[model samples]
Target: MRREFKLPDVGEGLTEAEIVRWLVKPGDQVKVKQNVVEIETAKSIVELPIPWDGVVAALMADEGQTVDVGLPIIAVDTAEPGVPAGGAAGTAVGTAAGAAPGEAIKALADDMVPRPPAEGAVEPGAHGSPAPKEERQAVLVGYGVKTGATKRRPRKAPAPPAAAPAAPAIPAAPVANPSRVEVTAHPVPARVAVLAKPPVRKLAKDLGVDLAAVTGTGPEGSITREDVRAAAEIVAQPEPRPARVAAPAGAEERVPVKGVRRMTAQAMVGSAFTAPHVTEFLQVDVTETMNAVARLRAMPDFADVKVSPLLLVARAVVTAARRHPMINSSWDEEAQEIVVKHYVNLGIAAATPRGLVVPNVKNAHELSLPELARSLGELAETARAGRTQPAEMAGGTITITNVGVFGVDAGTPILNPGEAAILAFGQVRDMPWVVGGELAVRKVTTLALSFDHRIVDGELGSLFLRDVGAMLEDPLRMLAWS
Candidate 1:
């Protein structure tokens, strides 16, 4: 029986997902709960499993195609024998020419079964018939086929000529057998089997590199995407550009904004216009905070955890929020009230390949220093890997963006859609400063706090920034304030 698998909502109530790659192809056998395709939803990249075991009959959607939820993406033949396939329940029903539309699909399943070649049968060729490509089984959950030496049914070699008692001087007329004639006239080229992922194979094809000629550097001698690209660089010549060429008038490239970029743009625009933003800037000597980060790194408890200046900043924000609860709040326009959250869900803005995503730690104010460090590390890693679940991005009371990573000083960061404020951490640099009424060099960094004026007034915003700045200026003050 042929079964069609529709795209399921992986989570987050996603309405659609882009087909990143198809791990199974037509004629390939697949099992129940096998990851047959990888899809990119609005939240993350997910591998979708096939529910029924069968041979893949067709792929309804191509890679990079956006498919809606409940739409069929792959068709699998599940019937072993006897039972008939029908059109209902996602099964494909087919019929011969001049047959009814509801006719049972029996021919498809039968054709899928392999058969032996008859005696004196003509081998598949360009002039005779198209050659049958070898089909290999694939793994349960990955971009590779089943790993092992491929075994193919051997073809019977031509029989040796028998010695006759009487020898004839003239040569006998050719038997004119189609297989022998075609094989002798146009010899078939030997096929080289190479182990490579589908994406790597596509890359090799695009680069015009023969996978068989390129040595693989991956596990089990498998070819990787980098191997294909490197081989392409060595073999493919760069196309020379035409001097002084002009583009056609009114020519422009158009890109469809649909995924994370689209979501980010929408949120930024909404927050920028909807909220009356008040930005407060402060320059603080973070020399003490940097030293504290170094100390934390040396601590036995933080031996396995990654401690950074951001961790100190996050800890400071959480500590300061406890002092000024209004800073950790949202403007409820519908309710005509400011909702101040008692527990801080501190959002750390992370820039990923998809776009800007803020996955927060739940009840950050309650977590210990080490626990907070671990949460921050896990959140960043998950966001970078494009695996941050939708739930991790919700219920953020306040956010902090570390623009310092890009050597940026500071900027007025827009509030995350529902949050009341966002803090931008600038690059810490050695700058001349007055210490004890004398000139001295210190690690100084600028902080920009942008908050929703409707929720947090200037007095509240400044005090919050001052408190955060003070924590960074004197790392010991966090313990004192806490």
Candidate 2:
């Protein structure tokens, strides 16, 4: 029963995963249902488990490789009677296509964890044969396999110590292999980098701030987006750059934008170029909404939720989306069809090292205020942790990008590659405004909604903007509208 482990869809709607580390190698015998590898998706780190007891054959994917969901990561051979497992004493897994065990999969990382190898004596460089590559360690991985269907790892018959200067190899005698061998255990769990979202990482890198030195007030010693901004402000007053080494290349060091950077560049360019973006701006007087947010924080309904203007914006968008269903639609070029989604899978564009990932809340309109808040928090946290699964990022109806949090008025927002619309919220500031025909200080902010004109008309677009502004301007209208 040879098996290969396909990358499973982890949580947070992740479509692809990066192989952080491997736990097993080729030719190692493995038991069923063991941990094989630790993968980092757009959301966070996840350990993959094996399905069958087998010897590891080969690893289909390499460490740091981003593989799509349902793709093979490892191959293993189910231990069988005829299959000769390992050749060398330390050699693991006999050769045949199969999955690796989860527990025995820890490989030599910076932490120096040893993982189990793939099965059957891989004929050194040949399939179904034995090869010894002791310098490199490997781990077995299980995709989605069944339980108790795995075979035990069989140690090889030891070669007798160089007898007579290796005259002739002894004919192996059948011996009952040891039932189990103790594997080196992992001392500590992987550190979860709860640093700021993607933009913050970019901001810190651009500003040359040492992320390691900044003390994070966010949960799990993770730096929040605010932390980076604060550090930037303090340092900006004096010397612009942080105290670091001189430019070794002195004005020349054109780093090539490869890997994630290249992909992000191409993605942004394609989105801006293809999407005929019409950005409609709305400057709302959110004074009443701010008061409502403060009061909501005192209420029992919002006890577990974090209240902010963004929450209100989320509510307003959902409400407006209901009235304007086209906001929740997509423009399908291939089928020559317009996808007007009745439901809102609201996506929040997050910046991370892996690039821009807009993980959305599933069916946002159905949830209550507190649930919505909680969901948003969880989504942000998952995205920051890079644990978000491909599934969480897919099926987005519409999106909200918080340019306001960045203290910017508004940006000509680009549409998410597939979605029809994206809303960019600007910073709420106290500015002089005309109130009752008198100049007064008002907490005013801008809302820029960029819609795909192909699906949404000018009339529909204006109405959606006006409705959202009305809700923010006077939240009481939300009750009447509902």
Candidate 3:
């Protein structure tokens, strides 16, 4: 018995996923719930598990190929060990035990000889096959007679034209024993496997470039797109110009957008166009907030977690959102109303190798200061490692993008889709400030808040920004507000 495990919807309503790698190869025995493959969807990378215990028969999809949900990616055979499927072993054993010598020899010859297909027969995936390549039926291994299909071989040169008619050749004498047979052995030419990804291979095929002849410049000598394109250009030239210099490897490159980067691009474009954005900036003296962070770091409660200015900044935002709930709400166009969220799923935008992923802390408004700091630390660590899940990114009511880490002053950031407001925290530095009518150097930072004008008007946006700045300027304000 054989069973197929299709690619399931690992993420919420994901339609497709790219196979990143195969953990289990053909002939490997796998148990139920054992991870077999890792795949990357639009949101994140996830590992998939097999559903039944069996030996892997085949890998239906190639790595780097994006497969649709519910399509079988692997086949597993459930038959017992040492027993071939379809009673092939039983037949072979029975033939060797009771069959006559001639009959047994005949059976062995039939198995060894390559037989041509019947007239009008078409091989799978060949022209005039019963079904198209995408809809072809999958066959189990070791179940029936083998097909004549084989791996691709180099094309042979055309034979010379036939000569004019001549005298008939004499026949050779037959062997003394009729059952005796003589077979000639032919050496097969070894083919070197091309080292190129699926996309690069496709590009070479489309450009009519032979990968075997082209030199690979990619890591580990894998062929890249630029190498294929260069080969194609060389072939396209009418004549080789020895004086012509070849272009540098890094002169041009193309990257395919597919995973998290693609999703971020689409979301940013949609949010930028759909939401009418209104930004407000305010420069605040955060000397007191810096002092408070230093104090919290020494305390026993905060000894285990990291204490940074961003932690206080997150706390301030939560406090301000509680005062002005409208800033944390989203505008529902279909409902034609402002949807205010009572709980804040505060999102922190982290720049990862993949892209900008905003994995938020759920119910941030309800967490204490120390709990919020720990959550922020965990979220940052998870995003940096590229392990943030899809669910962790969803349901964000408000977001804070800490541009301060990059040593930037401020930025008018676009809002995350479905969220009404996004706050930008700038770098803190010692600047001239007028405290009690005296100019003195103090730690100051800028805060830029961009919100949807449809729900949060100018007054509400300003109030929210001012409240957050005030809480940061005087950390005691958070105690009073709470």
Whole-model Cα lDDT of every candidate shown, in order: 0.77, 0.71, 0.80
Please provide, for model 1 over 35-75, each residue's C-alpha lDDT reduced to its tens digit, 9 standing for 90 to 100. 89988777667787888888987777768877645545676
Better of 2 and 3 by TM-score: 3
TM-score of each model, in listed order: 0.64, 0.60, 0.66
Q: Report the C-alpha lDDT of model 3 over 389-420, residue by residue, as the tens digit.
A: 89999999999999999999999999999999
- Candidate 2: C-alpha lDDT: 0.71
lDDT of 1 at 271: 94
Candidate 2 segments exceeding 4 Å error: 1-18, 23-34, 40-46, 53-62, 65-247, 250-266
- The predicted structure with the larger TM-score, 1 or 3, is 3
Candidates sorted by lDDT, best first: 3, 1, 2
Model 1 — TM-score against the truth? Answer: 0.64
Candidate 3, lDDT over the whole model = 0.80
Q: Least accurate stretch of 10 residues (summed lDDT) in model 1?
A: 96-105
Error of 3 at 236 (Å): 29
Best by TM-score: 3
Which residue pairs does candidate 1 place in steric collision? Answer: 1-79
